[model samples]
Target: MTMQDSTDLPRDTSRVDSLEDKSLLLVDDDQPFLNRLGRAMERRGFEVRTASSVGEGLAEVRRAAPAFAVVDLRLEDGTGLDVVQALHGAREDARAVMLTGYGNITTAVAAVKLGAVDYLAKPADADDVEAALLARPDALPEPPENPMSADRVRWEHIQRVYELCGRNVSETARRLNMHRRTLQRILAKRSPR
Candidate 1:
């Protein structure tokens, strides 16, 4: 979960009004995660539609724009931003959330600018999704319960740069101003908890 779970939020009887349409589009390349999240959203009273690629998601939006969407940032075919853009273009009031395992500022900003209500890291729970979807537009989201530590954030940044550098240690080190041997050492270790 990126922030607080739905349980942390107060039960709003009027939430039904905001969720009147109840239709949701979920796009993710991960089959198991998609299935699980789809089922969970169904349990939460949404009419869930699942798509595994950007093309499929765009097709679904063209057929019928959903009231809400939870789209993965990186799909097998393309980025989920395409889906979010189509959803908003089809329905101006649609609320979208972008999910990414490779969470970064650039994509997050792009997603929000494209009309997503929130950006969440992957492994987000159903409750977290619900909270984001149902949240009031004027209100701020709750802080994450377990935010990444400084070390973890640094590690993640390094890892992201490494990947961007095509996993070339020397190139990554040059970009990050780190020693090649030190970069290799960091990459060799497991991620911090």
Candidate 2:
């Protein structure tokens, strides 16, 4: 089913009051990640409502009329691209931030064309997300000149897959079409503090 089909679900209203007059809707399939990120946003003076699916997130947006939204590109049931469209439909002034572990030029460009204010790769710290949200209209950070580098593109690919799979080596390897051992070896070579 399409992401649009998923936005018809009910939502929670408990934390709506705490969102500092600036409402935010956060959508991700990872529940734990959502909890942590939602709390961080709330602490930063945003009223945060979270959903694990695109459908529920959209419902929250309709209910809360948030000023901003942070959406994951890939949800468990649908993609966040549809969420971007829905948010824009709800509030023309609303800013949407696309968060994903699948970082690519095509997707980034599509996000912008689809109305996202910014696109961020996964594992992005809360501060980074906040900074992007607070950036002025003309001050949005530019995307990397060239996101793909020959020498390190493979490493980046692995990292993105790993993050998208929630750090599960097996899932990452499967998605990358590589053997688990190879993925582990690559990860092992990285410097550790």
Candidate 3:
């Protein structure tokens, strides 16, 4: 079913619309990422507003009464967790999602306890963000497994080197002290799930 049709969502379209016209408050320190994500969310039928700092985000939340907020863990002025708390304090129904470049179970669990709906790591695309939002209140999805497990650390390191080299196999191999063929073999074995 469409997210709008989900019974778990707030029922009144007018309310949703009123909030949508003002519904989303996106807080991130990275201006470009915020703009990109805001545009992506807008394309998916959300009305998005942005803030570069926690104080500004909190002000916008108080002013707009947004139904949902996407908050980055690190802000220029403070932690996004602070914004989440303020938003929840102002509007109990407001759902908050934490976005971070650094992912850890400790922070994730703490965010949930502080009233965030869920925590998502950076590099997540629009679909990932949407899926997080569409989850039922009692059925939040488990976080994806870390790509840097012990068994996968070597492969993960190779992948990181490859990315650092802009995905050029030869350059990545040179940096990782591995033959190009070896890097390719490791990559081939560990295709993304």
Tens digits of per-residue lDDT for model 2, 69-182: 899999988889988888888888788899998676557777888888888988777887877666666653656645556646667666766877999999888888899998
lDDT of 3 by residue, 1-193 (tens): 6456567775633122333343788899899998999999999888788999988998897787687889999887888888888888888887888999866555677688888987898877887776676566766466566544664555555666676688899998888888889778887884333
Q: What are the Cα lDDT values of the candidates?
A: 0.90, 0.79, 0.78
What's the C-alpha lDDT at position 54 in model 3?
A: 87
**lDDT, model 1:** 0.90
TM-score of each: 0.76, 0.65, 0.64
The reply for model 2, stretches above 4 Å from the true place, is: 1-21, 140-193
lDDT of 1 at 89: 93
Give the per-residue lDDT of model 1 (tens digit) for 127-163: 9898888888877667788888898889878987887
Task: Point to the candidate with the largest TM-score.
Answer: 1
Q: Model 2 TM-score? A: 0.65
Local lDDT at 48 for model 2: 82
The better candidate by TM-score, 2 or 3, is: 2
